[model samples]
Target chain A: MKPSQRLLVLLFSGTAALRGGGFFDTLDDKTRFDSDALGLHADLSFMTDATLYVPELPAQGLLTSDDHVFFVPRLMTFFDAQMGDRLTLHTQMRADRGFDPGAVPDGDVRLDEYYLQGRILRDDDLNVRVGKFGTAFGSWAKRSLSWNNPFVTAPMAYEDVLTVSDRKLAPSGVKFAQRRDLPDNKTNWLPILWGPAYTTGLSVSDRIDWVEYAFEVKNASISSSPEVWDAAQVGFPTNPTFTGRVGLRPAPEWSLGTSVSHGTYLQDSTASLLPVGSSVNDFTQTTWGIDAGYEHGRWQIWSELIGTRFEVPWVGALEAVSGFVEAKYKITADLWTAFRWNQAAFGDVPGLDISWDRNGWRSDIAFGWRVSENIQTKLQYSLGDKSGREPEGNHLGALQLIMKF
Target chain B: MKPLPTLLLVFAGVHALIADGTIEGKLSVESMKPSPSRPGYLPSPTKQPVLKPESAPAIVYLERDDGVYPRTKTNETVRIRQSGYQFRPSMVAIQTGTKVDFPNLDEEFHNVFSCSKAKHFDLGRFRKEEASPEVLFNKPGVVKIYCEIHQHMRCFVVVLDTPWFVKTDAEGKFSLNNIPPGDYSLKIFQPSERLIQQRVTVTDGQTNTVNLTR
Candidate 1:
C-alpha cells in the first residue's frame, strides 16, 4: 500500500473505541496517526444559516434575500500535514466564494489560507511560516472561526463599511460624507480593518515566561481584498505591510494584549487620481489596538479597542475609533449564551468640519446548544442603526446549524 | 477428625462465600462504522474522504433502584495527567465525592477546563511542576474535560454514585465483586454518554456471567 493509505489505515485502527462526549459532549474526533514520523489530519465544519431582516442589513451585498428571509449555506475545511516534529503544512478552503471581500476570483471554492511552517526551537514554539496566513494584528483573528466565535457576524470594526474607498479616491469630503446616505453602495466603501487579513506573509512568534510576541510582514494592507493577497496579483504593491502583537498572561485567568499594523490602503486604480506631487504609495493606513480577556469558571469575557487613521488622497488623516466587548456564559454543559456590543465613530475631516463617515453601534445576543459532540446550533438577534438613521436595516434574527467532521 | 474450632471456621467461611456475589463480563465496541447522523452526501467540491468512528472505552456499573448506592467516603484520589497534549487514561469512572488530580506533566502549559453539568471548572494554565491541581466530584454525572489551549486534548470523568463500577481493560474484560445478592439495573455508559441498561439478579454464593453484546 501507498504511504497515504498506510497513514489512513493507521489512523482508523483506533476508531473502534467507544465514543465519548467533549466538554459539551459529542465533540468531533481529532483523528491521530500513531506514526510519529509523518501524519495528515483534517477537520471540516458546515454551517447553514437562515436570517430574517426587518428593514435592512449593512454590507447589503453580503447575503441575498428574495422576500424578507434569506438562507445561505457554507462549508469550511482545513487540512494539516505534519512532515515531522519540526515541519508542517496547513491549508484552509471554503465554499463561499464572495464571503471575503476582494476575492477577485469568481467561483464556489476559494483558498483562504495555505502556509508552510518550520519550528526553530525543539522545546519552544519559536517558528516561521511562509505563504498566505492570517494577519498577526488583533485578538479577533485567532477566534474568527465559527466554532471559536460567539456570533455569526464579526465585529463592526472588521465587517461594517465606511464611505472611504481604496479603489476610487473621493473628490471632496462633501462627497465622501454624502455617500453615507447610500449605505448600499458598498462597492466603494471599506471597513476600517478587513476581516481576518488573509494576506500572503511571513510570521514568527515565541512565548517566554509571561510574555508572548508575534510579528509579520504581508504583501498587502489589512484592508486589501483577498484577491490581491498574493504578490503576483496585478495591483499588489512592492512595499510590504508590517503587523505585530504583544500579549501578557500574568494570571491564568486574565490576559492582556496590544497590536499595531501599518500598510498602504489604496489600490492601483487610484494611481491616476493622485495629486501632482505624490504617488499611490503616499497613502497609508496606520492602526493600533488593545485587547483584554478574562476566563474563569463558567464565564468568559473579551474586549478590544481599535483606533485607526487613514491618509486619504486629498483629505489627509481621517480618523476612526472602533471596538467591542463580548461575554459568554455557559449555562450548562450543552448550552451557552453570548452577547456583544459594538460601536464605531469617525472623526471630522481636516478643515472640512464634517465627519468622514457615519457613526454606528450594534448589539448582538446569541444562544447556542451543542446537539452532540460534533453538532451545534445557534440563534442570534441583533439591533442597531446608523447616526440619525432609524431602522437602517440593521435589525436581524438568524439561526445557524453547524456540524463538524 | 477436625477440631470443633476448625468446623466452626469452615462453616463461617462457607456462609460468607454464600453471602457475596460477583458479576463478570466482556464489553466492546459495536462497530467502528461512521454514525448515521452525518450528511449523506458531500455538497463540497473536495474529494470524498472515508469517515471514521469517534470512540471511548465502556464503563460498566450497577445501579440500585433506590437511587442510592451505599459507598464509603474514601479519600483515595483518582489521577488524570496532562501530558503530550493529551489527557492520560482519557476515560475513568469514580465514586461520587472522590478527588481527581489534574497534574500537568507536559513541558508546556495546559489549561484544563470542563463545562459538564456534574462539575464546572477552569484550572488556569499551568506548566509541569511538582504540585498538581485537583477537583472533587460531588455530583454524579459525566464530566467532560478539555484543555483550553489544545482543542484536540480531551478526557472524560464518569462520576458515579455507585461504588460497583469498573472500566473495561484493553481486552474488554471486567469483573465486579462483592455485590449484595439482589436485583440491580446493570448499566453501561459509553464515553459519548450513550447508555445501555439491563436487569440482573444475583443469587447467594453465585457468580453471574452477564456478557453484553454490542
Candidate 2:
C-alpha cells in the first residue's frame, strides 16, 4: 500500500477510467501521462497587455514615459519534471505589473528558469545541461515563449530599447553617472536579450544528423545585468560567459542558424567604468548571429541577423546591428496573421560627445485568436523610428490575452 | 415428413451457386513518385486530390486455414467523416462484424481514438450536434484511426476475418465478390507498399486474376 501509495491508487483509478471510456479502453498508446514515473507537467499562463502611444509624449527622466499603459503583463508558471527516461527538471515562474526593463515593479516572484537535464551518450544524442538555462541563443531566445511567440513583442534582435545611463550634477555637488558615458540619455524600454534569456552555467546539447548544437558556459552576459538575474549576489566570475548555437535541418520545413557570444560584460560593480588600472579582461562582450526558418502548410517564416560588440577600455569599440523579418498566416483553423520588420544599427562612439540615436526601426501587424486549445488572443500594430529621436515617429497599440492551464 | 425437409433445402441451394468465386486484382506501385506540394497557404487545388496515405485506397485480403467466416449480415454502415480537417475515408476495409460510423461533420470537437493491436477504443470528445458514435469491429487486424484533438487526423481501419475483402480503385483496381471455393491466402495492404503474399486458386464459376506487381 505504499509504492508511492500504489502510485496514487493507480493515478486516481486511472482518472476514473478516463471518465468512463474505461481507461481510454485499455490505454497504452501514449500521450496522456503527465506522469508515468514521477511526472508533473504544467505551464500555466495568463497574460494581459495594452499599450498605446500615438501622438503623445512628455516625461523624459527615469527613462521616458507618458502615453498609455495597461497591466497584467504576465503571470507565467512552468514546472515540468519527468525524472526518468534520462532525467529532467525545469521551472520558470513569473509575475509582473507594467513597465519592465530591469524589472522592478516589485511585486516579487521571478526565478525565470532552473534546469538540470542529462541524457548523455548511447544514441540519446548527448545533452548535458546544469542549472539556470535558456540562451542557447538565436531562433529568438528559445522561442520567446508566450506559447511560442509568433509575435507579442520580442525580436529586434530579441528586444530593444536602449540608453543605459544618464544623470548629472557635480562640481562639489556630486551625483555621478559614467557607466559607459551617457549624456541626455533616456529610452530604456529594455530587453535587447533578457527575459527568460537566463544564464548561469553549463549547457551542452546535441542532435546530430541534420545538425543542431549548443554549448554554453554562462554566468552573465546578454546584458541587462543584475548578474543576469541575481547570480547569488554578484559573485562567481574569473571568466565564464561563452555561448553558442549551430542548427541546420534543411527541410522538414527548413531551419538554419548560427550564433556566438564571448565574455566580460563589465561589472566589478562597474569598476568606475574601468581604466584606473583596468582588469575584468579589459571589458569585452561579443555576439554574432544569423537565423532562418520556414514552416509550410499554413505558412510561417522567420529571419534574423544580429551582431554586437563593445570592447571599451576607456570607451572605444561599440557596435550593434539587428534584424528581423517575421511572417505567419493561418487564417482559419482559428485564425492568425502576422508580420514584422525590425531593424537597428549603431556604432560610432569615439570620445562620445553623444548625440547618438543611431538608427532604430519597427513595424508590426498581428492578429491571432485561437480561443480554444487553451485560449489565445492578440492584436498588435506598430510603427516606430528613432534616428536622433525626439518622437521622430511612433505609434503603437497592442492587446494580448493568453490563458493556458 | 414433409418430403424430408424439402430435400435438405434444395441441397443448400446448389452449394450456394457453386461457391460463387471472382477475385480479380491490380495493385502496382514500384517507383511510385509524387510528393512535392507543401509550402503553406493551401486550399485551392480541390478538383479532388486529398485522400492521403500517399493517395488512398489499397487493402486486399483472403487467408484461410478455413474456420471462422460467417458474419455477413449487413445493413451497411461504414461512414467515417469529420470533414475539412480531413479523415473522410482515408482508407477502410471492414467485415469482421462491421459497423463503423464516426461522423462529426466538423464544427470542431472530434476525438475518435484507436490503439490498434486490433482494437482499443476511445471516442470521447464528441459534438457537432452529437449523435453518431458507433463501433462494433469485433477484431481482426489493422486499426489505426486517430484524431484525438487532431494530431493530423488519420484513418485506416482494415478489420477482415474473411468475407474476402477488397478495396482498391484510384486506378489500382480490385474486385472480390462471393469468393468461396478455394485454396486462398492472398493479402496485400499497401501504404507505401511491401506486404504482399500470394498463393491463389479459386475455381467453380471462375474469374481469378491477381496481378500485384512490385
Candidate 3:
C-alpha cells in the first residue's frame, strides 16, 4: 500500500478505541504512546443515494446518477514536538479518498487540510499560523468538519451556501484566542457572561485582514478571490468585502448570535469589446443571518434565519430569505429522533428568471441509533415543495453509518 | 460585672450538651486525572455523563447519643416527588431506622421500590393525595429506588449510622454544622465523580475545612 493508504488503515484502527464518553480520560495516568506521539483519526461514511437538485433547470436539475452506495473515507493526522516549555511546532495533514469524480484527480490521496500553528506567546494565549485552518464561523461549522455534527449530512442551507467546495477547507491564516471567567450567573440580568474572553488578528490571502473575538464583535475585510492581488492594471479595482459578527450566551441554556457578510465577486476588469468576454461588471452578494439554540435535558431545539441579496451589476438584484427550526429528542440514551422544517423565498428580479422564485418549503425527519460511542447509524427522509415554479419538489431518503475517532 | 454569675450559669447549661461545637466548611468538588501536564482524550462512553459536571447534591444525617442528636430532630420526613415521570431529587441519604416517605405528587399513580443490597421494599401504586408509603431503613447502605412504570425514574436511598455528615449544595459545597469538637473521620460521596476521605480535628470554637477533587 502507498504511504497514504497505510496511514488511512492506521487511523481507522485507532478510532475504534476512541469511542464512548470522555470520562474514560481518567482511566490511565501515564502516557500510552510516547515514541510516536502519534495522532490518527478516520471517519468511514456511506450514503445510499445522494442527490442535488437545481430549481433553475427545466426538469428540476437532478445530479444523482449512481445508485450504488458511495463511501468517502477521511484520514487526518498531526505531528507535534515541544520546542521547550513555551514553544511548540505542529503540522496537520488530512486526506479524503473515494471513487467520486468530484474528488481529487487520479482517485488518490487528496489534501483536505494542512497547516502549521505555533505558539507566539505561550502564556499570553497568542498563536500564529502560516498554513490553512478551518474557518471559525458558526457553531456547527467549527464543531468539526468531519464528524462533529449530530447528523451524517449537514443542514441543506448550510451545505449549499456556506460550503464553498474548493475553498471551504482552505482556511490559511493566524488567529489568537484566550478564555476568561465572568462574574455573571443565572441570577444576573444576563444569565451568562457577556464579554470577549480572547481575540485573534490575522492576515490571509489577497491581503485580507480578519479579527475574531470570543464574545465581542468581530470584523473582516477581503477581496473576492485570494488568487488575485493587484487590480489596478487588471481593469477592476479589488472589490473589497466586509463582515461583522456578534454572539452571546445570555443564559446557560440559551445562545443567540448574528453575523453579516457583504462582498462582491469582482469581475475580470480587462475585457474585449465583444459582450461575450465581459457581459457583467461585478456580482455583488451580501448575506446576513441570525441563529439561536437551546439545549435542556434530553431535548435540543434550534433555529436560524438567513437572508441573502445578490445584485448583478447590469441585471437587477435577487433576494433570498431562508429559515429553519429543528428539534431533537432522546428516547433512550442511545436512540434519538429529530424533525426539522425549512423554508426559503427568492424575490423576483427583472430579466433573470429562476425556478426557486417566490417561496419554498422542506421538511426532514431522522432517527439515529448509536451502536457505541464512536459509531452511529442514521436514516433520514426529506421532502420539499416549491410554490410558484413546480407544484411538487423532490423527495430523498438516505441511510448512513459513521465511525469516528 | 456583678451579673457575671448569672451569665456563667447559662453558659454552663449550654455546654452541658455533649461536645458543644460547630462545623462550618465548604466542600469543593474538583475533577482530577493522572496528569494535568498532558491533555487526555475523553471518548463517548468515557465522556462526562451530564452536559455539565453537576455533582449530586446530598443531605446526610447521623443519629447518636441515644436520640436524633444532630439536626435538632431524628424523625425525618423524606419526600421523593414524581414530576414529569422523573424523580425530582435523584439521590437521598438518611440515618438508619429513619422512615422514608414517598409521596406521589403527580396526577397519576406511582409504584416505588428498591431491591439493592442496602434496602428493599415495595410500595404499591398510589394516587395523588393518597397516603404515602413508609420504609424504615434498617441497614447502612444504598437503596436503589425506581418506578415500575417509568424506566428512567430513579433515585437512591443511603442510610448511615454516623451522626456527623453534610449535604452538598448546588455549588458542590457542604458543611457539617454543630459537629462535636473532636477528631472525626470524613467521607464524601458524589455519584460517578469520586469518593474522598479525610481526617479532621475540630477545636472548641474553631472549624476545620476539607477540599477534595475527583
Each candidate structure's TM-score, on Cα atoms with residue i matched to residue i, is 0.74, 0.32, 0.46
Which predicted model would earn the best TM-score? Answer: 1
Chain B TM-score, all predictions listed:
0.77, 0.33, 0.68
True contacts recovered per prediction: 0.04, 0.00, 0.00
Chain A (alone) TM-scores for all candidate structures: 0.86, 0.32, 0.59
Output the better candidate (1/2) by lDDT: 1
Q: What is the lDDT of residue B63 in candidate 3?
A: 40
Off by over 4 Å in 1: A1-34, A37-67, A100-107, A230-236, A389-391, B1-85, B95-149, B158-162, B167-176, B179-214
DockQ, every prediction: 0.07, 0.02, 0.02
Give one digit per residue, the lDDT tens place, for model 1 in A1-405: 545335434433322232233322222333323232334323343333222222254433233333354444456766665565567777788775356422322437767788988879766667798888888888888888777777777888887767777887777777666666765445566787778878987899877777888899988888775567766455346777899999998866677999999988788778899888888788899999999998765677899999998899877799999999999887765688999999999899877777777788999999987554445667778877778754247677766656555
Query: Per-residue lDDT for A245 in model 3?
Result: 52
The Cα local distance difference test for each model comes to 0.67, 0.57, 0.44
Q: Could you give the CAPRI-style class of model 3?
A: incorrect
Instruction: Using TM-score, rank the candidates from best to worst.
Output: 1, 3, 2
Give one clash count per candidate, in the order shown.
Answer: 13, 0, 19
Between candidates 1 and 2, the one scoring higher on DockQ is 1
Residue A217 deviation, candidate 3, in Å? 14
Lowest summed-lDDT stretch of 10 residues in model 3 chain A?
A172-181
Candidate 3: C-alpha lDDT: 0.44
lDDT of 2: 0.57
